[model samples]
Target: MRVSLCVLLPFVFFAQTAQYTKDIEVVKVGVIFFNNELELVRAFDTAIRDINELELDVRLEPLKHFVSEDDSLTLQEFACELIDNGVAAIFGPSAKASSDIVEVICNTTGIPHLQFDWHEENFYIHTRNHKLTVNVAPAENMLATAFLDILHMKQLDWKSFTIVYENSRSLGRMELIFGWRQVHKAGIKLWHFNRGDDYRILWKLVSSTREKNVVLDCPADIITEVLNASIYYNMTGQFNQWFLTSLDTHTSTIRSLNSRQFIAKMVAVRVRAYMPPPVHDEADVF
Candidate 1:
C-alpha cells in the first residue's frame, strides 16, 4: 500500500503553527532533495497533492530546492533561501554533510527540520538541547536493540555470524550488537565493503569461514546487488540465513529478488511499515 503524506502533515503543521501565530491560512514547507532523489521528490509531491485534495483549512505550499548531493554550499544557499521565503519547516537533502548544514541552519533559525533517512548520530544523546530537529527513522540504538531481540527470539544468539556493512554509517547501526557480542563473548566477525567494491572477495572469505548467519547493512539502493553477490557465492541456501537492516528492503527490486528460490531464509526488520511508492508500478522504482 502506498503511504500518504497527509498522515504526517497535521502533526507537523500543528507543531509548527503552535510556535507561531495561528492566524495563518497557508503554510509554506521547504524540501531539499538531491538531483538523484527523484523518487523522494515524487513521493513528496504526491503527498502534497493528496493533502490538497482533502481541502484542509490550511493550504500547504511546497518550496522545493534540488541540489547536487555533494554540493554543500548550494545546499546551504537553498536552505537559507527557503528560510528567507518564510518556510515553517524544512525536510531532506538526506546526505550526511548536506543534512548537517541544513540542520544547523534550521536550528539557528528555530525552524523545524524533518528527516526520513537513517543517521548515525542520536541527537538526544549528542545534542540534548537541539529541539528543532525531527527524525522519522528509527534511532540507531533502538534498531540495534531490536536486532538483538530478533537474534534471541530466533535462537541465533548462540551461533556465530558475520556482519557485512557498506560504510561507517551502516556499521554504527551495529554498535549495540558489538557490545552484546563483547558481553556474551559471542563469535562475530566484521567485514566492510565500499560502495563499488567487489563483494565476491568478502563472500569468498565468509564462505571459507563456513558462516551460516549473516547480518547485512547497507544503503537501500545497493542491497540487491550485494545480495545477488551472496547468491552467486551460494550463500542463500537452506543452511544459511540472512538478516537485512535496511528499511527499504521491501522495495520492489528487493522484493523481486526475494521471490526467487532459496531466498526465503532471508529476513528483514523495519520500525515503520513499508509503504510502496506511488510509482511502484514502474520497474526498479523505490
Candidate 2:
C-alpha cells in the first residue's frame, strides 16, 4: 500500500559541528549503479526533466559504476569517495553489501542516504542508523502478493506449488526466500534456494518434485538455463505457473529471447514511482 524511506544524518556528530547545510549551494543527490544498467542510469539522469517537473530546488547527481559481489574492496573504496566528497545526499550504493557498506559510511559521516527498495529487511538493518531513510516501493511482499493473486487466478491448489531460487550474490536471491516463507507457510509443498550448481544436472529435482506449479527467484541466466533444461528434459507441460525474479530488465531480456514463449512465463518488480511522464527520453542516467 504505502511506505516511506528517509535519508538521514547522524545526530551525535551534527550536534557538535555547525549545521552542514550552509556551505553547499544546492543539494546534491548522489547515485551509484552498475555499468550494465547504462540505459537505466540514463533514465535516472533524466531528472533534469524531473527537477523541472517536480520544481524541487535541489537536483540529483549520479556517480555510477560497476560492482560485483567479489569486489568488496572496490565498493568500499568508492564508498569512501562519496563520504570524502561530502555528497549532501546519497541515493544508492546498489548491491546489498555495497549498500550496507555505504550505510556504514553514511552512519559514520552523518550523510543522508536512500536506496530503492530491494527489501524491507534491507531497510530494517539500516533504519537503526537513524539516518533519514525510506523505502520508495513495496519490497518482498509485492512479489509474494502478486503470486498469491496468480494462484487465485488459476484456481490452483496450494499444495502443488514450490519455489526455486539461487543465492548467488544477487539481491532477490535469498531475499524472497524469507518473504515466501512468511507469506505462505501452509499448504506449501516444498521450498529451496538452489545452490549455484550446474542447474541442468541438479534439475532432476524439478522433474521429480511436484510438477504442477513452480515459482523461482532466479536471475535471467539461471532462468534461461532452467527453461532450456525443462524444454530438453520434458518436465514443463503440467506447470500452471512460473515466476521469474526481477534480476534483469524486461525490455533487455526480451531483446535476446523469443518474446511470445516468454510472454506468459516472466514476472518482474516494475517500480515506477520516480517515473515522471511518457514524453521524456529514458537513457540520461547512464
Candidate 3:
C-alpha cells in the first residue's frame, strides 16, 4: 500500500544552480500540459506560493502552456516559445509521445526538461546528451524492481502471469517486465485494452485464456470499470488474482471492492511517494 520515490541529485543541482543578481533574481520555468486535471493545476499554483513564502534568494515564475495532446506541431511551437522566452526548465505534458517531442525541443535549447511520465526503452539506447532531461518520477529500472519484487513476494512464476495495459505509456512497463523474464528464463503474454473496446468481450477473452495472474497497468478512472466487468463475469475468486499498477488505486472505494457477491483478490502498487518537509516548513517535493 505504500511506495516511495526520491528525486536524485541532478534535480537538486538544477534548483541549486539557479543564477541570481545581487539586488534582484528570478528563474522562469514553463510547463507543458494537455490534460485538464484540477488537482494538478492546484498543485502547480501551490508550488509557486510555497516557493514565494520560502523567500529564497531566487524567485520562480512558472508559466503553463496548454496544447492539444496529439498535436506534434503545436507541441514543438509551444516548446520553442518557452525557450525563446528564457525558461530555465520545462515540466510535463504527461503523455509519452508529447513528452518525447518536448524533450527533443528542450535538449536542442539546452533547457532542463522535468518529466513525471514514462520514456520509451529505445530512446535510452543512445549515450547522447541526457544532461538536460530531469525526471522527477521513479526511474524505469526502479519500477521494474518494484514489479519483480511483487511477483517474487507472491511466489508467482513469470510464466503464470499476463500483462494488460491501456496505452503506449504502459508499454514501457510491459517491456521492462518482459525483459525481467529473461533473467528468470520465462515469458508471459501481453494484451492491450484500447479506449473503446468492449469490456465484456475483453473479460470473456481473459476468462477464456484461463490466466489467473494478471498485471493491469491502466488509468485510475478505468479501474472501477474493469473490476465491475470482472464481477459481472464472476471473475473474482481464489482462482483469479489481479495486480494493479496505478497510484490512484488507493483512492478507490473499499466498500465497492468488497462487494457481497464476490470476494475480490487484488493488490495495487503506487510508483510515487511524497515526503513531508521539515517541521514548521511549508516546502514540498514532487
lDDT of 3 by residue, 90-207 (tens): 8776644544677777777788777655555455522454557766565666777677777766344445677778875666555556766652233576777886678878777777
Error of 3 at 6 (Å): 9.6
Q: Tell me the lDDT of candidate 1.
A: 0.72
- Which lDDT tens digits does candidate 2 get at residues 1-286? 1111222221122222324444433444566665565554565556434443543333344455566655678777876776666666566644444346667777778776666545435456665763654445454556555545544544444454566656533334334444444434443444455646666664566666545566666655456655655544444544435655553444333345444343334434343436555654332121
Candidate 2 matches the true fold with a TM-score of 0.61
* Residue-level lDDT tens digits of model 1 in 198-236: 888888888887778898888778888878887767788
Please report how far candidate 2 places residue 188 from its true position, in Å.
Answer: 3.3
Question: Could you tell me which 10 consecutive residues in candidate 2 have the lowest summed lDDT?
Answer: 1-10
Q: Which stretches in model 1 have alpha-carbon errors above 4 Å? A: 1-12, 15-23, 122-129, 155-158, 182-186, 258-264, 273-286
Higher-TM-score candidate among 1 and 2?
Answer: 1
Task: Report how far residue 35 has shifted in candidate 1, in Å.
Answer: 1.4
All candidates' lDDT scores? 0.72, 0.50, 0.65
Give model 3's TM-score versus the native structure: 0.75
